[model samples]
Every structure is written in C-alpha cells, then in structure tokens.
Target: MTSLPEDPSSPIGESARDTAVRRLQEAFSEGHISHEELDGRLHWALTAKTHGELVAALAALPAEKAGTTSTIAAAGGQIRRRGAWQVPRTLKVASAFGRVRLDLSRAVIEHPVIDIELQLGTGRAHITVPRDAIVDLEGLHTGWKDLRYKTRRSSRPGGPTIRISGMVGFGRLKVRHARR
Candidate 1:
C-alpha cells in the first residue's frame, strides 16, 4: 500500500451530518458508490447527528479487507503462528481505517519481517517488538500526524524489518522495541 500525503491544514468544523454528506459526495465522485446508493446513504448519514448514528451510517458502507497471508495466521482480527524447523518465517500485517493490535512478545523466529499498512480513523494503536531483534523501518506515511517511534537499542544484523505506511486521521501510534 502507498502512503497518503499529510494535510497540515486545520480540520473542518462541520457538523456530523454535514461531514457525512461531504464524505458521501466524495465517495460517489470517486466511484466508490453508485448514485442511487449514495443518495440513500447520504440521506441517512446527513440526518445522523449523534456519534452512534454517524457510526451506524458509516458502517453501512462496503467492507474491505487488509493485511497479508503468509506462514503466519490471522483470524478474528488476531494473529498467531509458530515457526517450524528448517524454514525461514515472515509476518506481514495490514489494517485499513480501524484499530489494530499486534502482540509479538511470544513470537519465535530466526528471521522475521513485520510490514504494517495502517489507515486509522480516530483510534490509537500500540505495537511491541523484541528488543534483541534488528528492526529496519521503511515506507511510513500518515495524514494527520507524524509517525512516532520509540526504541531502546539500534538495529543489528539478522534482525527483523518493520515497515509501516498509510494514513491516519486523528490519533497517535506508539511502537516499542525491546530486547527479549
């Protein structure tokens, strides 16, 4: 996935209804929705004033799946896997416009690379990595704020490579790399 350009300008102060209408119009223009469907949903979203109402309206939109499939397994939004002998393992993660939690504290791999593509809305996320592993990061992009990284030690040889890219609306991302 490609990174979205950051917009440093101030956010629009329109009401939820207005915002919904604007989003619907943009979606239609972008060919994400048909005219009749856009009209129906735009009416509902525009009339939604409360947070729950707006969420409901937005939830009616089409569903899109993110992330990748490899030796690792992901189900019900949780990822789990075990490495086998005589095989090099890799893990890839991706999330679009939602919250994603990654717990790599129990991972056991000779060599691993974690690639994450995030498109967050307003929710925050936390990512933890092994300290003894080497982490090489690349392709990190965000729309609302700068990507944040916190690590204790520097990268070492034969360690893991963590790549992140995508868009964020209003939220903070914290990544902690610690030794095992």
Candidate 2:
C-alpha cells in the first residue's frame, strides 16, 4: 500500500484528503450516512493533518454498490423527478404523449457518471442538471425537432457527468444547466 504524506498541507496529503472527501460524499448519497454524519466526517477529512486521521474520517462506510438502475414510465401522464431525489447510476424513462421533466439541480447524485435512457413517443421532455454537470446528448435521436441544449464551460472539474441516450419520436428534448 502506498503511504500518504503526514502533513496535510503537502500535495500528496491534499490529494488523499480529497479522495476521502469524495468517498464520504458518495456514502451520504447512497444513504449509508446521514447528512449530519457526512458533515462531521467532511470536517474531519478536510482538517486532518495525518493519514490516520484521514482514514478515520472514512471508517465504517459500506462498500459502494456495483451499479443500480431505476425505471420510470408513463403512458399518457406526466413524469417528473425533482428536489433532493436520489439519482441512481442508470435511469430508464419511457413516456407516450406525456411530458417528462427531470430537475436534477437539487438532487443527490452519488455516481460520478449517470446514464439516462429516454424513449418518448410524443410531447416535450426537459432536463435541468447541476451547474457543474457535464451533459452528453450525442446518443439521442429526435424525429420532429432538434435537441435544445447550449454548451458551456463547466465551472468545476471532475463534476458529475450526465449521459442521455435513446429516441424521441415527434417530440422535443430540452436540456439546460441549472442557474443556481
């Protein structure tokens, strides 16, 4: 095993601390830890001066699941997911003549990359992702209208990536980054 540097101010120590913090965030998003516990552990992880202290901040967390998939389908009604909802690793959405809205600005996203597959028969589908999120719409096919998405520079490096795929027949797909 590679030994981490003792001084937290060192580059190696900072990198180790960052990794620990990401793990803690993932644990919280996976429901392995409460918000309070995550906050406490994050404090320790950021302030730790030694490798042992950093390890202690990540103690007892359950192993991350390999991957989880969730499906949402609607025949004639709207499908919406917003506000602090837990985002799985893979999501499948199917709708027919119904609007689909996914607001992920305030969502709890654990995985570094999330895949969303959409199969819409008709109607418009809108998605609002986090400001730092990177979106890929290359795999999406629209029949009637063009996909509405404006590309911009990501504010933060190593942020979550949202990969959207599948087909939309006679419907429009609009994707935008969150303002707040």
Candidate 3:
C-alpha cells in the first residue's frame, strides 16, 4: 500500500477504497471468492479507516484483467442483440434515427460491472437486464422523455452491475429487468 494520510475520507484514500471494493466485487463475480468471503472483504474495504486497511481488504486478489469494448451502432436503422450473446466489459451503442434493443437475460456476463455508453439521437432504446443485476444510470442524460426503469428488491445481491451512461436526445430510454 502506498503511504498516505490515515483519513479514509481523503480524496486519495477514498479513491483507493473504491478501487479495492470494485476489485473485490470483480473477484467474487469471477469465482475467485465465495459469497461469504466477498461479504467479509467488502465490509472490510468499505469500513477501512486507513490505506493499509484498504490494501488488506484486497489481499490475495490478482489485478483485474483488461477487456476489450464492443460497439454496435446504426445511422438510421434499428440495432438489436439478444439470446446468448457474450457481453463485453464495456459496450457502446449509438443510433441516429431508429430503435435500439438489447436483451441480456441469457447473455454470458463475466464482469462484475459492465459500462454501456448509449448515444441515441432520435429513437427509443430498450434494455432488458438480468433479474439479479443492478442498473446504474447516474451518468445518463436524457431530453424530452424521461427514462423508464422499474426497480425491485432483488433477493440475490451479488450479481453484476450494469452502468448505463451517455446521452439520449429527443427520445425515450426504457430499462427493465428480466422475468427469469
């Protein structure tokens, strides 16, 4: 652990803690640790008061593997990806004047967190996430129509988090969780 101030709320310390927490979640999703272990490590990482404690929470975990991003775009037509497709760690979807549909109910997801950047200019974008997944839209910007998302209290809490970002100009973005 790099020597730093002992305050956990400091800028550097907070960033380090966030990274450690993400790594722990990734390790859990990658099957490197059990759910119980993940819970314990996550607690340690979240409540760490010092950089040394933060580093200890990530002990024995290997560095995160680098992954490529996949992009699907359409200038004036529709874009769709369904069935048992393989999901990359990062994805970019853009549509200029048509519909966009992404169904991830049966996709092969290996990452603990997936980042999807959507750029839709004048159409609707629909996303069907897995039942246990968490969707984050904090970075998304919309216009004219509000985003549609139905939140549920998931029984299983350790699934991958799907983060949707980017902008949607003059269109609607609908997001729903899978039934199964």
Candidate 4:
C-alpha cells in the first residue's frame, strides 16, 4: 500500500486540501461547474506537488455571493439586516467552519417586505423565522455526501418558525426567501 506523502506541513496540506475540496463542492452545488469539471479540479488538487500549487488550484474556483447588492456590510463577522423594509432586499451570507445561525424571531419589521439569501461553505447552519412570514428555501450539497435539513411549522399566525438544519461536509448551502 502506498501511503500519502508525509511532511512537516502534512497537517497544513491536509487542511488546505479539505478547504479546496469544500470550495469545489460548493461551486458544484451552486451549479457553477459540472461534475466532471469538479472531479478534474479535485484530482489536480490532490496531485498538486506543493502547497502553493494546491492554493492556486483552489483559488481558481469561482466564489459564491449571497446578495445582489454591490454594497456589502459585514460587521463582527455577522451581517445584520439594515435599512427600511420596502423593496424586498436580499441578504447574502457566506461562512466556513463555525456555524452561521439566523434567528429572525426577535426582529421587528415595520415594512411588509423583505428577503433573505444564505450561503455556507462548511460546518453547520440553522435559520429560524416566523410562521406567518412568507419564505422559500433551497439547499445543495455537492460533496461526497448529501446535505440535510429539518423544518417545523408553527401554529401561531406569526409564531416563530424555522426551516432549520443543514450539515455540509466539504460543501455549502443556499437559502432564498421572499416576504410580502
């Protein structure tokens, strides 16, 4: 059995490989690339001779953006929704490793319109909303396995509800919702 190369940077290499795979999986999930293309990229990444080469290969992949707006406000690693709710704006979120949970139960919306868009790179994510709040959700996991989601409906007209739960193994998830 031929063992994988082991160097002082083995751990880093592994980490980099994992990251690259996750990004590639995300791209594939988002329909940015075909399965064959993703497989080819993964093969190249795994066969990369140096860390720099691996990094370059990963960087070559396309990135996922959540919002349609050009102005991005990212604060404290958390991008809180801002401005008046009228035109039904979109909220885009992207993260890796740590979980990104959106609890909109406490949010007070004066306007009658809003929207949300979520993007995950890896790890776990949970999102909650009011039952009365109009929502549409979708998720895709293009890794070695499938992504998961758990949702619960509420009895209250505006009771806090959720389209919760998503787990990604070297992958990503995106959710888009519109409120009226």
- The weakest ten consecutive residues by lDDT in model 3 span 1-10
TM-score for predicted model 2 compared with the true structure: 0.64
Best by lDDT: 3
Compose the digit string of candidate 3's lDDT tens values, residues 1-180.
234566654544676777787778778867899999999999998988776677678889977676548999889889999999999998999999999999998999987789899999999999999999999999999987899998867548788899999999998999999999
Instruction: Indicate the worst ten consecutive residues by lDDT in candidate 4.
Output: 158-167
Could you give candidate 2's per-residue lDDT for residues 66-142 as a string of tens digits? 55789999998899999999999989999999999999999999887788999998788999999999898889888
**Candidate models: Cα lDDT each:** 0.53, 0.86, 0.87, 0.49
Ranking by TM-score: 3, 2, 1, 4
- Residue by residue across 87-152, what tens digits does model 4's lDDT show? 223445555555555656445543233444444455445554544664434433345435443343
What residue runs in model 3 are displaced by over 4 Å at the alpha carbon? Answer: 1-64
Q: Judge candidate 1 against the unseen true structure and give its global Cα lDDT, from 0 to 1.
A: 0.53
The parts of candidate 1 lying over 4 Å away from their true place are 1-98
Of the pair 2 and 3, which is ahead by TM-score?
Answer: 3
- Candidate 4 TM-score to native: 0.35
Question: lDDT per residue, candidate 1, 129-174, as tens digits?
Answer: 6665544445655667666775564566656555555555675677
Off by over 4 Å in 4: 1-88, 110-113, 139-180
C-alpha TM-score for every candidate: 0.43, 0.64, 0.67, 0.35
Better of 1 and 4 by lDDT: 1
